[model samples]
Target: MDPRCIPEKFFDIKETEVLVTRITGGNVRNALQDIHVADALFDLDELAIIHHTDCGTLTWTEEIIRSKVKSFAGKEHWAEIDKTVYGAVADLDEGVRGDVKWVRAHPLITEKLKKGTQGFVFDIESGKVRKIDV
Candidate 1:
């Protein structure tokens, strides 16, 4: 499911335009570049970076995960699963911090999305959302 497509009960806005992209191999920089180009062409307002809990991408290192998948699935699946798990330890605070830092540091998105843009970490256990300090 697209993270942007998820319903927000408390958070209200005029409208939202969803840019659904397949993010694989942990290449967030390239993905943000594509989104940044689209945003510039369209004149977007704000950007939100969302990383969910229990995401499979956080499970293993790129090499280990790829080898396992290749052994079970096929060699073709290696490229798509080559995502390094930097800080996917299920800590809400740490995850949010890492994600926000990554988005803010991205060259394509940094200028467009300044302090106005923000990062949020959602806790499924407590049903709460908190802003992350990048």
Candidate 2:
């Protein structure tokens, strides 16, 4: 499934176990660390890291994006806009790999969780999801 579509559709089911985490500053590892620390009570069977094609987040550098926004809006708004853009531009593959790596490498999750973690790449054009060998 498309990563962008997951929240609106996959997460809509009431029975689904969802932990909505928004990691800012484009730091995937830091975000997962926070989740691991906070969500110890829940039973996490598998981790799904989804990335899509044609994602606007992948385009543009932090400085350029901020400058463009500031040009249109104002200099005072650059900081907030830069932070938001960075958060969204957090690479999907990197985020997924970091999360799974953390789960497998960390003593906390590895000790309690028996299921192995994996990553996937979703192609929006072909509508196919393939396992990513990282």
Candidate 3:
């Protein structure tokens, strides 16, 4: 969750309207539950998965992070962490596209929400959000 990537400043929308669920690499796979919760509670009009350039996840591999975790958190914790997807995204555009597709394909996500689900890449350097056509 980068502090620079403020949704309201970039999107020019009121804070109350947007449900910003920030996750590592902006992986929608990790956000399915949040979407489900939002869907159950509110009338969600659209869903946007925004990944950013030069993300922290791009810097490390699963093996490296697992090793670090194993060293710090112990073998049992490492094994559990290894079973999880740490959301290490290699390519920003591909990550956004993949997340969008994953979110859209999920059976639990409502049809209307799936239709409205869009992917975008926030350029940390340029301070711009570019929509990725999936």
Candidate 4:
């Protein structure tokens, strides 16, 4: 996770106030690896999904990565990576919508967190975060 994205300074929050995890959008949207979070945040209140401009996940689509990996990293390597979702986003608003939808719909997260959910778009150049209305 980039400090610039959810910086402690963003809300004048102390360092201990947040726990950041850097993952592909697919992980968020598909709810692949959230068991630990469900346990850890059992007493949590809210959640936020922040997708940013110029993310590496946006550099390549899952289809493109699937097609090219064999040639670039060999067949075995491609097989290992094939199961993963690239989590690429071509449109920020729509991507945020899908991510927020999934998060809201996730069975584990829905029950674990009870208060609020928000999505955001961070402008890499401006170092600004804007809320996306879901």
Best by TM-score: 3
For candidate 2, write residues 28-131 as lDDT tens digits.
Answer: 45556655754575656555555555665566567776777778997777678867635345576775566566566866554445254566655666766767
- Local accuracy of candidate 3 as per-residue lDDT tens digits, 34-102: 888988899687998898887898898888877777787866576698897788877888888888889
- What 10-residue stretch in candidate 3 is worst by lDDT? 70-79
Candidates 2 and 3 compared by TM-score, better number: 3
Off by over 4 Å in 2: 1-4, 7-14, 17-30, 68-115
**Could you tell me every candidate's TM-score relative to the true structure?**
0.59, 0.52, 0.92, 0.73
lDDT of 4 at 121: 81
Quick one: ranking by TM-score, best first?
3, 4, 1, 2
lDDT of each: 0.55, 0.56, 0.84, 0.67
Candidate 1 ranges beyond 4 A from true positions: 1-10, 13-30, 72-91
lDDT pick, better of 2 and 4: 4
Pick out the ten consecutive residues of candidate 4 with the lowest summed lDDT. Answer: 26-35
RMSD of 3: 1.3
TM match of model 2 to true structure:
0.52
